[model samples]
Target: MKSSGKRGTRSFGAVELLPTWHWSQFTFFTMVDHNGNESSAPYFILIGLPGLERAQFWLAFPLCSLYLIAVLGNLTIIYIVRTEHSLHEPMYIFLCMLSGLDVLISTSSMPKMMAIFWFNSTTIQFDACLLQMFAIHSLSGMESTVLLAMAFDRYVAICHPLRHATVLTLPRVAKIGMAAVVRGAALMAPLPVFIKRLPFCGSNILSHSYCLHQDVMKLACADIHVNIIYGLIVIVSAIGLDSLLISLSYLLILKTVLGLTREAQTKAFGTCVSHVCAVFIFYVPFIGLSMVHRFGTQHDSLLPVIMANIYLLVPPVLNPIVYGVKTKEIRQRILRLFHVTTQTSDP
Candidate 1:
């Protein structure tokens, strides 16, 4: 509902509401400066893929395909895991949560990205921008927590095979999932609020196709020491801690794997191949983006933008593919599902 009626400004109507709230729809306003000057209150011009404006249509095609494949593939994983009685295990359940997170996070950015590349529509309402930032960052933190939970599940399953069922029972896994969500939401709650409260008197042009915390933080006109410190603490306490614990859990898992017979070791370690790939896909780009943001400030702007996009888009696209092709159960179930559909449709 926050928008300016200036000549170049754009207003998104009811279609922009995340969940279609009537009261929050069809309203508009302009920003009032301290000296009684009025300007656009809640608008940002997203400079998507700078210097590549001519290739926007070409860029949209591949990105659109990635978005579709990510959604369909992850949804398929969820459906198979839920419907198949044989897959009602802790690992598949965690995978289902992972898929759901992928869909949620990607949805927050992909729509706006398509709008930018396809329609050349780059104006984003301020509130919607904050919402997108919240969803992307919180869901990213949730992904790390979910991965840590899965690491613990594997640690139990391999190291304490006898106690695996009792330790990671359905209720316990559910509790872990709830804890992950709560922890993420609690830690990331201040991110959007911090960015929102900051005065955006300067250029509101986002560096990428979608809203990201770092991208938005740099645009604030006010002193941002508090926001910077709190954001760092949230990242360290949540994602950093989860990454460290996940590493430790895998170390213990490796120790347990080493104690088994050679054949048993191969079989046991195969279970983690998919997870390791997914971890790398998610973390490598994230870590790279962080490093570049800190150390490569003098480098080309396109590099950071590319890294940030990869940090966001790669995991969702790769998680389902890795799980589907690497995990035997999912692959066989997908084949069987298609086979049944083919037979049913034969006339």
Candidate 2:
């Protein structure tokens, strides 16, 4: 009988030949299979600027504390203005709106950022990330618009004192506040929609502790040329245009005030100084951040942190302080409500 085991044959005969395989080809196939397996698994790596642990800790702790103070301070202002009948005017109404915006603004990013630092947790859900981005930018945009409106209100009140009551009536102030909200929402809503639609197939790690527009956009896989162009247009129109208008309004106010008597001008300037300071503290860093993010180098991570603190946290903390110290009536009212004695008696 023929051999019961398999055998290799060189010529055709009654026996079958076994298939032959080259060892080199088998090794090459194995190597390719191993590489394909390695490539198929996704890798997770922490990617962002380092050396910020100490700075982040210091910054985040104080910022979180200040955020609490900001919320309480602004809320107190809103309550005082709303409840006190004597404070019912266009200026105070605008102040109340500003205080409300401050609360929203601080609450938007500071708390989450603090948690990230304290917990060493940097991962954020895609939707939550987008929401945070929208909230912060939207509130910021609203704040700028509101500042412009407030400047106009002051302009009308001081320059056109005769028509202040008619021009800045309750209905009119409400209408202006509504318009500011709508305008801000309209301007900022598009940013998130554009960002969300972009394909992010590569790195998911955000450079900053929070979800800023440019930071998130950097991770996009698809082309962002159009998005960048639209972003520039929006920033210029919304922030730049608003800043220019505010500056012009203040210039006119300054001209009008300068023409008044020394005492009158000082008093008028005092009335607006708080708002002006608040606006400056709020906008300078804001515009600076936009510029730096757009034009600055990738190594400039400190810019975002510093800018975030200045524009996001500082204004909210300082606004109440500025207005409280500048405005005597509100200060006294707050003292009276809190039962703090301001008067001294002599025997």
Candidate 3:
């Protein structure tokens, strides 16, 4: 816990925007000082949507539906891939990891948000908040790494078909995934420690329905220069660098694809459509979130809140759908699964 009764006054950086913890509206504001405890852990209140408070109860329906769909869809992908021997290949293995990460990303924040929306349980303990923050950011980083690994898988499969088997062995992919988990965990492990050291003397009222490191750190009365710098470093080194490498991997993939015959080109590119869709949905909101944080010094807008919600929700919901629809193998298997279920139920 890092909050308590009262408020203090302080200003650390430029104005920042606050997004809803779930898919809802929120107002952005600058952090100012208030009088409160220097070291005591303080609880926080979650605001689901700023202007649309009355509708939050109803909004819970859709948000909960989306969460269920996200979880079930991703979990289905994992199950299908695990059970289907044909899908034990490197590509689907990576897809399984992606789905797992998606489940984690959605689960990290959605449950508490549901509580706020449906039950009006807006209060979160400080330690729980820290745990949620770590889960969200670290899982997000792992997803980015998985996406990058997928891009590499596609590159090797298409560009160097002969080496595809050798390059992306099951063991190698497992190693890469383990490395991603390790890297993300190791990098973000310091975040909770950093925030915990600061004294939150400002208003314990958080801008979003969930705890974010940036939002949480903003309430501190003490200097958070280390937090700020280290946060930036983590973003750039992990997600930003992964984005760059994924792009490079695609560039090489495109180069290799272009050398193929017309028919070969179409077939080759089709394999990437699902991945491309996933990449866009995952990164677009991420870019939006980053830009809003970077440039949100002068005004308040819905973009920050909107982007934050989308960043967490869209990828998880869409990845499985895209893969299920675009990839023939997955699509056929899913259909067969449903058909079997229908047949069994009818009897």
Best by TM-score: 1
lDDT of 1 by residue, 1-347 (tens): 55544554444542221211122122333444435543434776676676677897798899889889999999999999999999999999999999999999888888888888888787888888888888888899899999988888888888999999989989998998999899888888899888877876545666677887877888777788988799789878987898899899899999989999999999889899998898888889989988877677642378887887788788999999999999999999999999999999999
Query: Which candidate, 2 or 3, has the higher lDDT?
Result: 3
Name model 3 segments beyond 4 Å from true. Answer: 1-37, 297-302
lDDT of 1 at 320: 94
Instruction: Put down candidate 3 lDDT per residue, 10-51, tens digits, no spaces.
Output: 243322222223223322232323431234334666767666
Which portions of model 2 show Cα errors greater than 4 Å? 1-49, 54-59, 340-347
Residue 196 displacement (Å), model 1: 2.0
Better of 2 and 3 by TM-score: 3
Cα-based TM-score, every candidate? 0.88, 0.81, 0.88
Model 1 / residue 284 / CA error / Å = 0.9
- The TM-score of candidate 3 is 0.88
Off by over 4 Å in 1: 1-41, 298-300
Q: What's the CA RMSD of model 2 in angstroms?
A: 12.6
Least well predicted 10-residue stretch by lDDT in candidate 3: 14-23
Residues 1-347, candidate 2: write the lDDT tens digits: 44435353222233222233322111111111212221110111121224666566665667778889999889889988998999999889999999999999888777667776676565566777888888888888888888988888888878899998988889989998998898888888888898867765444555566777777777676788877887788789888888899899889999999999999998999889988998898887887777777677764366665665677788889899888888887898888877643344322
- Candidate 1 residue-wise lDDT at 311: 82
Query: Relative to the true structure, how large is the alpha-carbon lDDT of every model?
Result: 0.82, 0.74, 0.82
